[model samples]
Target: MSKQKKLRKADAATIRRVLALIAPYRLSVAATLVLAAVTVISTLYAPVLTGQGVDLIVGPGDVDFAALITLGVQLLVTILITVTAQWVMNLVNNRITFQVVRDIRVKAFEHMQVLPLSYMDAHRPGDAISRITTDVEQFSDGLLMGFTQLFTGVLTILGTLGIMLVIEWRIALIVVLLTPLSIFVARFIAEHTYSMFKVQSETRAEMTSLVEELVGNEHLVRAFGYESRAEERFEKINLDLQRCGIRAVFYSSISNPATRFVNSLVYAAVGVIGAFLAIGGSITVGGLYAFLNYANQYTKPFNDISSVMTELQNALACAQRVFDLIDEDPIRPDAPDAKVLPHGAGKVEFDHVKFRYVPDVPLIEDMCLKAEPGQRIALVGPTGCGKTTLVNLLMRFYEINGGSLRVDGQPIDTVTRDSLRANFGMVLQETWLKAGTIAENIAYGKPDATREEIIAAAKQARAHSFICRMPNGYDTVISEDGGNISQGQKQLLCIARVMLRRPPILILDEATSSIDTRTEILVQSAFEELMKGRTSFIVAHRLSTIKNADCILVMKAGNIIERGTHEELLARGGFYAQLYQSQFARS
Candidate 1:
């Protein structure tokens, strides 16, 4: 299809989707339309009343003073009703616009929860945030403008035309024939500006992403002396946005004046035709005056609509982005008869698993492992050797291409994901703590945990001493990401969270890497207590920490190169020994 045809098709689809979203508020929409009709009809009747008053005042003292006074009162009542109805209509429009925006934002966020991790890895978080927040705000503005102006404009035009035709059909026909000129000009300019607006929206999203990235990593930027480079990068995107914005605004701005010029011609035609008719005595002077007023009213809507076309174009563009996010493919759902994972001895088995992120580029191929009940399995590997990938697959964060993973002899996929995940507790190298009290952070996995239970878990994770040192102890509030605490303290809080869960299986991926050597010794002892009789998988680089593990698996390039006890691996003098010696040699 041609580009113009495609844009028109997309615009139609966007309108349909927006209408679908607004379907629940049909009653309010109907009320707004009724109010608009009342407002327009009242506004049109005022001009008719003025014309009658003029007719009553004929040739100085020949005027009917009583009739003029009555008409003036009627005009005043009509104006008041018009103002009141318009005010109510605006309130309804605001409610609908903001409600629609809220629904869209909420729906977008809900969809994000189900979206695949790969989707998140492939897109910038700031861009997603912009679509939900910034883009939705833009859509609300456009929707409000359309509801406020477009509805009234259309009703006014139609009402004025009907009134004009009743007084004088000839003038009405002249106005009708000339009015299409305004529409044609508006359509031509609006079509050209739509693509520019789309470009501008996309550029704005890119700018948002860049700013978020730079600001979030401000410390790193300055520490690495990257301020100048960062500024240059930001300036480049800023310039692109400026150029796109200017072109869009400039093109859209042409629509208003071009349509206004056409409307002016229609008004001029009605005036000249009405004058001749009144002079020829085919119409009363008062009737001719009302027709001229109706003619101006008929053309005024076109100007109002043309002026709002720019906002509508930009709104539709942003709406499309939001809808695109809502329509992203979510993670695959579980089977119809998926069962909840039952609590049992943790026996995890990976049977000939094969997986890769990019097609045809193998990362973990033909991998097989089995962890028996109450065993501590340690995984040691160089970077990019599929260590963390194993943890992700175990947690079902990503599906393996060819695999049958089982937990306690039941296929992992046979159980609901939430149920399967509840069987394991995880603590990672990167710690995360939401803004809350230290006790709350510790009891995150178990919200109903008591204060005593929270304190006990903290003690088990070797974090209780530091927790007591805080100003309010367990009651003290911390910021998100634990900005007020040390990195070691944050890691301890994360460990305490897992301790509180006490799941059947545990996955510790460099869980103690952030702590100091002294604290590491204490936390490691606590981990030993936590791991008793529970299946644990440890991914670590420091070989000393795993010296007493039940089994150690040395990995290289997605395959296990060695599996044995620490003494057995060292006696063999293989890759494991070299890796172990390399770390100690550095010390």
Candidate 2:
């Protein structure tokens, strides 16, 4: 009820989502609560026995050894039972909490796989990692601690209140009257912390992003001598995070002590009131002691729960971010009527295709191109002139706005996305390799590739010699994100991956950009040989790269201004000729 009353509208939704995450673990939760309840009962019995033991003291306040020993044995048993129950309850609670958190993390990762690249483009990968790793842990810790305290705290309060009433109604009234005062103070302090905690969460995420960026590009930062600037940026974010954390903690710090102080006042009132009741012979000394113990017990849960109010609010803020990501609509799945695409002969036709990164900003309008089986198509233009965009469209990475893209006489959209993409191989300007052995990275697209297949592909991509020079050759483990290897080596690994796939169509977007001229010539020769029977789309900034292309579409701005082989474009003395000559002239 306290948690329910404190939650605002936004938190209400997040709380529900978090509860949904726990719904599947209802049996474990129920078992944990049952253990907690047993612990509460065992715990509540101790103070009652303590008061009874006090009742056995001699009239002159001398030690009643024989009776004291008997009571001590009972008290020891109660304490052991209480301790054992709590320990087992804690074990169960932790298991449930971690499993609930793990399930959410797994679901979030699976959702990420189905999300389109457009979503990834709009957000940083580090922020997503924070949601899965940082936020989930925060939520799990709060839930774990919250559950342990909540179950026992509730039972302790209600049990103590009932026992206090049975012991003395007058003292029970004092505790009942002061409970609201403690709650009021806690609520006031906790309300202010919610906003501060929200800010703290955002600041923490910003710091995570900065750390990821700096570590990811440590080489670039040092090469450019930007260490001071990086430190300055980090200090700015770190200070902001520190300030937000201090304010959030400061506000939360006030809540527990304030609640405890209010409850302490009630404790004093109960003591003062119980003494008078005893003096008037209305209740026995034993009754007085039991009521005091019960009154303290009744108020302590409120204090304990108040102590965790700040933690709960911080957890709720994290829960909101994680839920926001979970609630994101994933990329559209294949249509209900979608059919599997047959193996391709690589006949691609772009029929009056229209595309743009953003709507209303026309990039490629009414663009037409046709590539028969075994033809080499080159797209050449300045940066951002829809060269890579064409490759993206052909591979169905982005859906074309106003056209049908067909492969071997079948409309691409009519088939399942998996089958549509399975026929094509791509090597982008940005090469990606995971932390794995050289053989594993090369065999990424085809996990079952034989050792000979892997070595053959590596040799064709010109990666074999360098790979052999490494300590473990194909079995050597690369560092994270392929950072241990050179950029050209990473590119070669990517090329080797594509070569192993041997798809019917290929898209090479400046694949040779990272290598030296000498290495590029060798890699290019391997690619040229590999491209012989596949429909290939090559996007090249270097005009010389397209000299032998079967067809080259010279793009300017977004549209193709000229189309021909290299010789025809030069003879026309047009945009292509001007662009081609300008490169050599500069060199």
Candidate 3:
């Protein structure tokens, strides 16, 4: 696997694409923004009232009762309005954020379905899960909170600044100049912190993969005495993840306190300047007091804006990772103009087909073979000699690198994958069963199969006798991957599934290799019945298994070296004859 690269800062195009996902909720977002603005306006009024109340109490005459009461009531009303607006904004933000996260997760999973098998083979399952869970959660929390605080902070700053300038421009000028310095400091910190977040995400994904691997293969780990090694590997990943997380937190942690310190200095400067202006008789005492209050209010928004700026950068890093996955091109299937395979008569022809899993290592080279309807063709080869590769090509798991293969005289490439695969039945060496009842596993290939049909298929595979002997018979619940059953039984269940499908073409890849000799005899008899009217491709390591095949093809080093009926090949004394003699001679 290739090493994952660090996440780059998102560009304008990527940001625009992320924003497009929320376009459908524009009206709700607008309402939330309006509420945020109203709340900011109401909050700004509280500090102004404090100044008014101070002036009212300090008036030359006896305390102005009417003025005091009026100011107090206005402050109370503004506080109530501010609280109500905040409540509404929170409700709206939560609703919108949840919906956005839901849509992102659903789309990611749906896209996985259309991706090519090669893409999945290259990525770890746990890493993919981390993207959907941890990364998305981070995005939702940071984006929703940052957007709300940002809008409110800007509105609050504008309202406070306008009031401050009206009372005294000099004090406001000091605040305006000092605010940019704080923003500059925040931007610098965020730039450095963003890199740390990217590292943290990758390290976390690695840790998740390690845990998944250990859990999925616990039995093998214990059998191989790998507990200590697994723990050591996990500890290394954990330490790396911790280091990355610490760096990210440390960089972001500086922003809040730094902003507060800068705001404190600006507030002091406003107080000193306001006192000088009042002494000079350029402003009334009441106006100077109000200007001082508005100065503090102005700096408060700057502090909030600076804090959110740091958080937004982290979210942008995560969004970059998410959008990168979403933007990958899904594999294209056959086009609408592609020809549909006619109802196949079970004839299969490989016309000079060639294939390679990687660029330089060819698995099949200039291979050609033909099987008439109902013919049983056996493919015999040493390990990695391309027997399984042939079956994979016939199923179109990977497209041919060169030449053509046809079924019933039609080129396989022209047919839709679904249409071609629908007519084939396969039994792999390793049987995989989901966590369900025995009946359900057998009926997996044909979900609409009747109960009687399922029972018949199981009987035909010679699995019905053992299945009936189980406590619950066909209703017996299998564990995931059929872990509760023996390896041979799992293979039998898979055979039963393929029998249920009853397709015109059958491919068996080491299908009976797991069973005992006696059980193999029973399965072989049932398989003969299944292959009676269908073209079949059988791959077996044991020569005894394929001795009765209509024709046997011997393969070596990606090329067919010999082909003949069993007796003819034995009499010819070629590679097949030698392999058979060596194997059976030992037994």
- Compare the candidates by TM-score and give the number of the best one: 1
Off by over 4 Å in 3: 1-9, 59-61, 64-73, 278-293, 436-440, 462-479, 484-486, 516-519
> Which candidate model has the greater TM-score, 1 or 2?
1
TM-score versus the correct structure, for each prediction: 0.97, 0.96, 0.90
Query: 339-384, model 2: which lDDT tens digit per residue?
Result: 9987779999989998877887989898888999989999998888
* lDDT accuracy of residue 437 in candidate 2: 95
The runs of at least 3 residues in candidate 1 whose Cα sits more than 4 Å from the true structure, single-residue gaps closed, are none
Candidate 1 lDDT tens digits, 103-198:
999999999999999999999988898899899998999999999999999999989988888888888898889888888888887788778888
The RMSD of every model to the true structure, in order and in angstroms, is: 1.5, 2.4, 3.5
lDDT of candidate 2 at residue 513, scale 0 to 100: 92
CA deviation > 4 Å runs, candidate 2: 1-7, 61-64
**Model 1: clashing residue pairs?**
none
Evaluated against the true structure, the overall lDDT of model 2 is 0.87
Q: What number of clashing residue pairs does each candidate have, in the order they appear?
A: 0, 0, 0
Please report how far candidate 1 places residue 141 from its true position, in Å.
1.0
